[model samples]
Target: MLRRFGSKFLQNSLLLTLSGLYSTAALHAQQPAVNPAPIPLNPSQKAAAIAGNVQGKALIQQATALLKSGQLDSAIPILQRASVLRYVDPTSHFYLGLVYDQKGMSQMALENYTLAIKRANALGMDSAQLRINLGNTLCKLNFLKEAEFDYKRAIEIDDKNDVAHLNLGRVLLFKGDNQGAFRELSRASALMATDPNLPLYQALALKGMGNNEECKNQLQIFLDRAAGTHSDPRVISMAQNLLAELK
Candidate 1:
């Protein structure tokens, strides 16, 4: 699967790093083992179906190339056509969702991601990364509870997925589950020691838990790491204000 996107895609669009998208595994051990019964087809029918799939794969390849070149508009129609083809790759819908997300069409992105999930599930290609992507879209739409479910599902699919833990923690923090957020963020920090955002999030969770001193310490750590980096100015400002409040 073409996991990497053009520089214009997902650039500072997510709070977490894009590195997770590339490192994710495509299959999970916990996925259902039962395969769907195969449908019997005559020679001519099977040949036609195989040809259709080949065409779908070709369209997906074309769309992927367009996406990598930052030609989002050109990729959309190709991906759309691929998505509706018989035996189409679920990744066609995933890429479509990514294009829509980059274009700031959140609803369309959410719908496509949902379709991708359904198709992936049917094909036994459901993965933690897929759930994380869907969760992120739901979060953008302010569907916090639904986002929480998807994040949790991602965690279940791959407990070692630090990105899933980080996102779940953020959602929990927003929902006032400070302790839950703290636990998940702590796990994320343990898994990805160098992610500067973890300490910032941990600080927020601590503040919500009335651990002001620990919050201040984490804030200072975040500030130190964020300095000379391309950290979000709003996040830096918020951290500074919180640090001052604890003083």
Candidate 2:
């Protein structure tokens, strides 16, 4: 994953208790008790919830496979069906967010991600992945302060989460906190050295600090990594041109 301004959705799925885009089996298995007990579900309501979970799980599985195949049109309805189930976990809402995000439905994505976070928190599962994803969506919607809070919260839960560090660096950079950006990105680099785009952000942080030599070195590192590993060609080309200018 790119360190700055990149979606952590895919990475977050793998890293968290939520395993994939649409698997809520783990959450369903737990059935965590709600903290402030509201009117408890009646027997009929309980039966419906159980039935909803079974149907929802099957729908989610199908939706996940469809999403992986780039079948967003097909996945959306399945995900929508899954989202209404009482037993559906944050993962379902999260994938719904992703599907909406992919379909250019920013408002819908934000709504579902928000719901996912709320549901996750209510379940007493402070998943770092959920926070990072919510942060990413918040950033996309220009909710920078909210994004920063989520990223910071993610770090608090899992201090070593590189995705949180990477995202926090970008948020700090945008806020003109270059030193803070450098610190977070450096920590991310320590955790994820093989990522090709990190040095580019580091270079930008150095440039903001007026440390031109270090900036150039970071740009060179980006170029080397880009050449040897996977990276967006547009980003790599930009780095190459910037490196020459720095030289």
Candidate 3:
């Protein structure tokens, strides 16, 4: 059964580097156990499955190309097919989760990310990035408690993970834990100062604590950097909208 877990093209090609949301890493396929238990497959069944695995790999490559070109709709079906293959590994499922995420299919994203994490753990691979990915999906679903747990667990695995700090801060803000949000956002900003979202979140935390002036200051800082260097239209718009709502 494990013979289908081929070493060829074991490296996942997709790199999920979405800032403030999903973290990234290519999934490495570990070799199966030596002399793995044999499961009886009829000749026809074996042939068909091997062919399916090849098709799965091709679909994964196609999906990766589509994702890189920002053709999310085209990538989704290919990734979905790849995930169902008998030899499909964590990487395929992880990419499927990412594609679903990009398409704003939060429920589907959560499901696939969960599957990816499970497969990663089963394969004895590191799952820190998958945890962050799943945590982001949980946040999108407003599952703050679960999201916090995932982020904290990821932080425990790697203390220097700035994305975990940033996301944890956002979740805390949503939970109305202003002080906690402030502390985590501060840590995240200290780790990556150029992140425009950090100050924007910190400002929200300050606003929740009734520090209107401080909040305004933070928003201004966010706006200045976001518009000048970082310059994400969404970030700039969010900061400007918040600033307008404040004064």
TM-score of each: 0.83, 0.77, 0.69
How well is each residue in 213-244 modelled by candidate 2, as lDDT tens digits? 89889878778767867566656665665556
- The full ranking of all candidates by TM-score, starting with the best, is 1, 2, 3
**How many pairs of residues collide in each model?**
0, 0, 0
- Could you tell me which residue pairs clash in candidate 2? none
Residue 131 in candidate 3 has what lDDT? 77
Residues 162-213, model 1: lDDT tens digits: 8899889988877778899999999998888455677877877787787878
Candidate order (lDDT): 1, 2, 3
List, residue by residue over 43-76, the lDDT tens digit for candidate 3.
9988887787788879988888877777888887
Whole-model lDDT, model 2: 0.70
Per-residue error at 64 for model 3, in Å? 0.6
